[model samples]
Target: MGIRVAVAGASGYAGGELLRLIAGHPEFDLVAATAHRQAGAPVSAVHPHLAGLDLVLTATDPAGLADADLVFLALPHGESGAVAAMLPTGVKLVDIGADHRLRDAAAWRRYYGSEHAGTWTYGLPELPGQRALIAAAGRVAATGCYAVATILALAPLIAAGVVSAEDVVVVAASGTSGAGRAAKTHLLASEVMGSLAPYKVGAHQHVPEIKQATGAASLSFTPVLAPMPRGILATVTARPTSDADPADAARTALTTAYADEPFVRVLPRGSWPATAATLGSNACHLQVTADVDSGRVIVSSAVDNLGKGAAGQAVQCANLMLGLPETTGLTAFGTAP
Candidate 1:
């Protein structure tokens, strides 16, 4: 008896990724799929990769998802709140958008300019104090794609007192897919190929989410659109705190944080990671080093922005909610080519 799951906004990339991860999950059955614009069309029309699945493209409705044991909401940020509000209490809900992530309403209003969607337990399983919270939460909100990489790369240092909340900088490059499945001029192949450009500099929405998660009040975060079609590589550099070991502390901090996590791996010293290393997968690969001359610790992180950052993480939380093993369907392996 697999847990029955429903996916709202099923025609999008995050939804398709959720479907892909759950299609073979030993403990889950993907029962319902919804998409507002593509309703009444075959799911394959939007996501050709899911051509053979027995899912229908329907509008997001509470009734269609009534029988689900769990529901994964892949709707756009502002849209999840209304849908989540209508679902039944017993059905566990997991949101892979920004709606329920921040605990502060003011911050939410400032960044998103909307009414606060009540906070849910965050879905980053590797955060030191977060797993227990997720295990007990009935509703969970997955971390933002950029925030996932940013938090994972910086949390350990913050926790270990190796970095302060002031003077931090993060610049991340992401695939166009991270922008979502919508049609936009900038994401067109003609505009994207043979080019890399930065967008949403200091004003990126994920900035507040990152600050809230890492407890870093002063952060300079920027996101760039890379030429590729998947994955995120975030380069973060921060001045070391007075207490930082100054030798192996940066590596030790990250290692200690993810040493036990099934999905996060800190690469061996000096072995730089690449986006291709984590494509089509649910792993977050990272490497950290300290620049003694500048008294700064530089950390680089990679993740399938659509995978471990969004849908794959939604599934991982669903597994926890169902009391099944965390790695039931996800693997740390990456595609090589």
Candidate 2:
């Protein structure tokens, strides 16, 4: 029998992506979908791509989520903790928001300005020491889109002690959808097109989350909005700890970490990952190169911000929690024009 699943906040982008993957999943069933603002409307109205689903949007009621064997919470940050608390202990919860990712309560308060929801099993199975963590926990926190890209690019080097975390710098460009499905002035096509601008330059919310994950206390993170529709291309550079060849060390560490991961691929030397290369895909593409003279290693990572960075990751965690095949419903192919 397939595992019955419910998705809260089903009217948004991450929820819609969950439905997209669930529609074809062999071991998962879409039992319920909830959306507070969109309750009472047909889900197809807000998510045209989900038109074939006969489900209607329901209120974010605990009873609705309680009926499912597994629940995916895709609500905004600071909104999931309360809902997660309300779900039954027997039901596994996979949160796609940032509410449950941080391990330290104080760190949570500093970055999110709210009471900590307490930590959940991190959903990035590709992270070093993450597979065992995911396999053992019931509640999972899917990583932030930007955090996903940045950490995937830098963690290997940091963990291998090849780079000093204090001197790291990450500059990432993401599509408007990363902001969310909400309508915002800056996300407008006319304003975003033909422009590249930075938001939360030194103070982006994801900085603390990134630092916490990679064990970096001092990190310079810059998040920029690219004028595209989907995907993120993160270019991360950091000075190596010593005379260790940055490129060779980065390649070895990253390759060893994700060598067996089904979804993250470390590319061949000299080839780099691009946003266009990973469009509409569940895979995270990575490439590492170094400037020996400058003494900096460049790690470029590409992911569909909505997929590997969000919903796809949520489903991947759900699969681990259920003890099913890891790649059950995810697509590895990127869309080609």
Candidate 3:
């Protein structure tokens, strides 16, 4: 028997993606799936893509998940903390929500307008020194889709001191799926298709998480909703610390940071990242350039918002937590048209 696992919040997009991945993982035995309103229905009723899965949707309660060796909580913001607190101490938990991503309590209150639920070991494995922490952590907080893309795009330069930590800006475009599977007027095909719109401009909840991840003192972030369904392209710009060739410095920093990483790819010179190239994969494609005219280093990164940015990342951290190979049951290649 493989590690028995359960997924809470199974009716949502993130949870469906987690189930899709778990169904193929050789070491995981998906034994339970839970949803609130959809309880007692077949999982396929909500996630049509998982048509053959025989599991029924159970109530999202601690007792229903007690048998799981690991539980992935894809609940909406502010929900995971209470559920996680009720689980047994030995059960490994991964939360794909904002509840545990920020270390600063004040920041959490300021943005989420709720009491801070406390922090978990962050789940972005590619960040320097993060994999080891996840390896030993029983509870992990998977980074936000937008925040992960932004952090990965700028972390190397920030860590290398080649860019000023005080000044950074990121404008990222994400497919509609990043908004969750919840029904919303703005997410309707009529509103989202053929349209590019920005939301939560200066005050996106992911801002504090980005700062926590990259150690940036100040950050301006904007998230754009694109017409597609599942990818993110983050364009990050930062001022260089010195007059050195910012492009070369950025390349060296990114190369050194990701040379041994399995999921992050630093694209060759002159090649830029495109969301299509990373669709449905856990890979993050990256490229960097310096604009001498603007005196800034610009980095672009692409990833499947639901993959590397969410579910796939949860699986990655789970692998480390369980002592399994880092790339087990995960892929780097995207699906092409």
lDDT of 1 by residue, 1-337 (tens): 7788999988889998988888878778888999988999887777898879866788888899878999999999899999888888998999998999999899899889999988999898888778878888899999999999999999888878888778999999999989999999999999999999999777899988888888887999889999998999999888888754643787888888787889888998779878999887889999988776787889999999999989888988888877888888998899899
Give the Cα lDDT of each candidate. Answer: 0.88, 0.88, 0.93
Question: Per-residue lDDT tens digits of candidate 2, residues 1-337?
Answer: 6789999998888898988888889989898999987899887888898788888899999998998999999999999999988889999999999999888888788888889988888888887678778977889999999999998888888989988888788889999888898888988899999999999878888887888788876888888899998899998988888785778888898998888878788988778888887887888999988875797988999999999989988888888888987888887778887
Ranked candidates, highest lDDT first: 3, 1, 2
Q: How many residue pairs clash in each candidate?
A: 0, 0, 0
The predicted structure with the larger TM-score, 1 or 3, is: 3
Clashing pairs in 1: none
Query: Would you list the clashing residue pairs of candidate 3?
Result: none
What's the TM-score of each model vs. the native? 0.97, 0.97, 0.99
How does residue 170 of candidate 2 score in lDDT? 86
Error of 2 at 148 (Å): 1.1
Instruction: Highest lDDT: give the candidate number.
Output: 3
Best-fitting candidate, measured by TM-score? 3
Task: For candidate 1, give the lDDT.
Answer: 0.88
Indicate the residue-level lDDT of 245 in model 1. Answer: 62
Model 2 vs. true fold: TM:
0.97
For the record, the alpha-carbon RMSD of candidate 2 to the native fold, in angstroms, is 1.3
